[model samples]
Target chain A: MSRLSINQQTVKQLSLPELIRACTAVGVDAVGLWREPVAEYGLVRSAELFTSAGFSVTSLCRGGFFTAADPADRRRAIQDNRAAIDETAALGAPVLVLVAGGLPAGSRDLRGARAQVVDAIAELAPYAAERGVRLAIEPLHPMFTSDRCVVSTLAQSLDIAEQFPVAQVGVCVDTYHLWWDPDLDAGISRAGERIAAYQLADWTTPLPAGVLTGRGQIGDGCVDFPAFTEAVLATGYTGPIEVEIFNDELWKRDGAAVVAEIAARYPACVGTAS
Target chain B: MSRLSINQQTVKQLSLPELIRACTAVGVDAVGLWREPVAEYGLVRSAELFTSAGFSVTSLCRGGFFTAADPADRRRAIQDNRAAIDETAALGAPVLVLVAGGLPAGSRDLRGARAQVVDAIAELAPYAAERGVRLAIEPLHPMFTSDRCVVSTLAQSLDIAEQFPVAQVGVCVDTYHLWWDPDLDAGISRAGERIAAYQLADWTTPLPAGVLTGRGQIGDGCVDFPAFTEAVLATGYTGPIEVEIFNDELWKRDGAAVVAEIAARYPACVGTAS
Candidate 1:
């Protein structure tokens, strides 16, 4: 249980304060948080709340949408990401997960859009490194390539991350997004120390409409969690193992119950004795 | 127009006879067929109908689902594929597309399942070759890796296809599935003469439930058709370019209108002057 962390998204129904209290009661010592909820609860105050409860903020949710076609929109996105970097630093999170946005509206140049992502990250890496926050590029599943993130493979994310200093930019390995990858084991091994954050979510079928909130709980789907965890561990990563599921059904349940269930399911997946 | 072909699935609402009439009316010289409807309309009769109408059977829709755990089930799948090869030969189709099935139920050994696909293909490749039918392995999008197909990349498809003789086993390249791949350009180039069929379908957002029937018609989504066609052409593949969209909305419309629209949209995507 030393490495276990419950991502705030796993219990989206809980407020920041309620989340901290629930984690304390459930004996979860760490958490991964989202930008919107932290801002809503007041960034500094939320940071203090976590500190007071002796909880470590493992990572900040996101900070990239660099695929805008308009020059002005691209600049604005960069600015927004800089602000997100500051927030990550303020919250004492070591990593800021970057979900490289989808293709711009009406633009079919996927290669061009991906080039823009690399350029945007190069510009942001220095800012993040200076602030002591690592930018973790999260490669979404290929299904989200058009509408969400164009970085659809762990190798693609590494292609961008390798262009920057390892301490500044790294890849976020999430099982839900990469479970289908044939080269996943090799990709994970290649990620090595470049793995900034490791996340777990199961892949359930008959993917819900929109496919955004369809992630299953740890044990509910087909992902081989123990194998996935073993691969990440083989990378020599000793950081927090965050369970971040985004199911509509899970969101409706009590936050405390959700966290408790996650805690219970963590050991079997990560191969750690409970 | 000579190189243009319409897959039967693009206008699934039409019966075999109605589809043949609609394609003939639209001046589509070629067609890719599905097994179920062809069987329903009588395989021999369907072949005769296409031949009488001066239509070339470009490729047969499917012939693989070889990931079953049971020995009997695996043998049955191989037998079914042999029958499909016979149908492809009888229909005078040059290629038989294989959508490799996903992991066996309650199993999480993705690598093992993929290995099984390679073995199954090897078992059927000789039979297909004997019938002068090329087994075209279709690499479905990674999203379908768990449920629909395990061959989730053109490279993976080629990995298996290359194991057998190129004349016996090749690959089906569908823009909808491969467009998101960062390695697509290189994969297409590597595929070279191993590309047995070239398919076109755009990638639309807000994927409908099940994700199977969510493929968009040409120019309806973000896939850069001209670019994709150029890549395939660069590989020296001058085969029939089939338009195969699986859209629920399109299925609700009139079949003749759908074929007409497909014909109208086909030239621009394939780089042919209208």
Candidate 2:
């Protein structure tokens, strides 16, 4: 229970104040937030609210979209990411997750797009490090490779992360995005301390249109959570385990009810160590 | 032109006779086939139609689904696959493509499901070889890992293929399924002689529900087709390059127009050598 955190997207309808109240009611010690919601609630006020309620911000949702064909657009993306870094710092969140952007319009050069990601991250990592925020590269599923994030595997994320200081850059391990990988266990082991954040969601079938917001809640799909938890625990990772499901059905329910259900379902999914 | 083949699914509305006439009109020398349509048209008659039209059947559409949990169902799948091998031989197709099935209902053991695929292929390879048919493992996109196919990358398919004689087992390389992989070139180079069927389709976003029939037409999306063709050709593969898109819009169009569009679009996408 001490290690469990509820990502706000899991209960997207909940207001910041309502979310804090629900977390307190459910005894959740931490929360992961998305940039838009935090901004909507006023970043400083949200930060103050969480801090006052004795809840830690595990991570800020995102800070990357560096692959653009236009040079000016790319520059703007970098600036936006810098703002995200500042937000992470203001919220007292140690990790800022990055979803490397997809291929630019009419550009089929995947390698070139990937190189841009590396260059963008290299430029941003020092800034993040200086602000005391770790940039966590979250590899989306390969289904998102064309339109969302070009980084589609933990190994690929690590390849980029290894080029930087471990304290400043690392990979985010999310089961929903990586459950099908044959080399997952080895990648997780190699990630070790470079795992800046660990997230939970299950792999469900008949993926929705756009393939986003289809993540299954833990125990609702085919992810072997115990095995994943064991693998992460073996890495000596004692950080918060955040539930970050994005199902449309789950989002439609009352926020408190969703939190209650998550609390009830979480214990069996977490490994023996937790 | 000699190396070009139109997979039936790319112009699925056409009957066997219409497909033959359209391919002949378009100067396509080969056609890849699906089991249901061929069976519907009469396997012997479909084979005769292609042969009479001087068309080589590049490969059979599919012949794998070995992840059933029930013993009887597993046995049935094996038996059905053996029949498919016979069909491949009867059609004089050198390759029989396999889409390894997904996890068993309610089972979270991905490794177990994958192991089952290995065992099923091991059991079927000898029979296929005896029929002078090479079993080509088609690694589907990871999006299909849960419900459609567990084999999700060319490397993983090669790992299973290497266990058998290359003459008996090979891999089907489809650009739509593998364009996202950073290691694709290396995988293709390593595939060298084990490359059986090479396919083409572009990667499009906002994927429809089920993520099945949403493949973009060639040149309509972000896949770098030339690079893929070059990689495969670098491996000395002088085989049929099949265009196999499964777009809903394409499916609704006139079959002859679809083939004509494919013919026009294909020249720009194929390698210089082809």
Candidate 3:
């Protein structure tokens, strides 16, 4: 389980300490933490809690949402992302995942919104790099393109990432967000060293209303994990394969049980064989 | 209004006769029909009803779903598609919109599944052409990529359509599906003469649990109808612009009112302005 990191949101019911304990119990030494929980637990203390427990902080959960319509909202988003970068540095996380925000209220200008994301990133990437936190532009699924992230394809993520230095910016690869893409293999290959974070979550059907929390657990869906892992790994991406499912059903279950299920499925799915 | 067609599904609350009345009430003389509804109304009767009402059958609603796991099922699908082609010809509809089926039961081979679609289409295209029905491959939104339609982008639909003779096969340009695509303009331009049908539906958020019926009315959501219509019309497509929304809320409303709303929205959204 060396390469497997339990992204905290996958088992959101657990406290930071509890999450760390569970990961260690399952021999998963790596954990990806979200900014909210880290803020609640005290970022410095959280860092110490993970490091003291001999666990590696894989990556920070988020630091994007850059596409607000209003000028003040846009400014706030960039400033908040900058703070997330500082937190990423403090926590010793290598990357701060960026979920590009959706369109402004009732706006049809998708091209303009996407440009705003790039502008926000250009403003923040240098700050993030200076703080030693690489920004990972996470391209959410196209379903969420209009309301969530305009960056919907891995190619689009890489296109934005390629603009900056590789050390400062990279693309986040989440199978749940990207498995349907025919050009996924090419995107991964192209992402090479720019692949900062590699996340695992499956795409299940009958997506829940609002389509926020329907991500399937690894083996529960149709994603070919071995195929996906092989492609990502082939790109010299020796980073943690973070399990970051957002299923509403899973959240109702015991956090430990969920971790156990994820631990077992990882090796069988995108783990050792791949 | 001259270019506008009231797709039957847009006002599904109406019976075949009621739909014809509703359309004619609002001065819309063009329509696109679905097979199940046609079968319910008696295909010949439905054809006659539209013709007798002086309504032009713009295009038949569907006939694809080719990605079956079993060989026998594949054959059945092809046979059913052939019947649909005949129905289109009978209704004097020049196009048969094809919503390509999703992955077979418990399958992850998207490439293989897509190939199955091409194979099925190849077998049916000639028969469709002989019967004077052009099969329009309708690339659904990528959200339905796994369960509803594997063909999810305008470019991909064009790719499949280009393989067949332009008259025998073409692409369906639905605003709801293709609007999110960055390369949509390119795809529409490339599809020029190969554009068989143009469908309009707005993309609304807080998508319903099934996501099948979340499509908004013309001006109800984010779709810039004028832009979409301009792009499609630029391709020399002189066919009826069909309003094919699948909103649950719209379905609950009075069919005649919905038709009136659509009729009003058409001129403002995609008609005279475009």
Tens-place lDDT per residue, model 3, A1-274, is: 7789999999999998899778878888999999998999998999999889988898997887888778999999988988899999999999999999888898989999999999999999899888889999999988898888999998888888899999989999999988988777888899899999989999898898989999998888889899999999999988888999998899999999999999987888974555
> What is the C-alpha DockQ of each candidate?
0.88, 0.87, 0.78
iRMSD, per candidate, in listed order: 0.6, 0.7, 1.0
Residue-wise lDDT of candidate 1 within A1-274, one digit each (tens)?
7888889988999988888888878688899999999999999999999998888999999899999989999999999999999999999999999999999999998988999999999999999999999999999999999989999999999999999999999999999999999899999999999999999999989899999999999988889988888889888998888989999999988889888888887788777521
Residue-level lDDT tens digits of model 2 in B141-220: 99899898999998999999999999999999999999999888889999999999999998898899888999999989
- Per-model lDDT: 0.92, 0.93, 0.89
Highest TM-score: which candidate?
2
Model 1 chain B lDDT-worst window of ten: B265-274
Q: Candidate 3 at residue A15, lDDT?
A: 96
Cα lDDT for residue B183, candidate 1? 94
Q: Write the per-residue lDDT of candidate 2 for residues A1-274, one digit (tens) a residue.
A: 7889999999999998898888889788699999999998899999999999999999999999899999999999999999999999999999999999999988888899999999999999999999999999999999999888999999999999999999999999999999998889999999999999999998887788877988997898999999999999899998899999999999888999989888888889986857
> Candidate 1 on B1-274: residue-level lDDT in tens?
7888989999989987788888888787799999999999999999999999889999998989999889899999999999999999999999999999998998888988998898898788888888899999999999898887999998899888889888889999999999999999989999999999999999998999888899999989999888888889888898998999999999999999999998887877766422
**Predicted model with the maximum lDDT:** 2
Candidate 3 local lDDT, B107-201, one digit each (tens): 98999999999999999998988988899999999889889899988888888889989989999888988888877789899999989888999
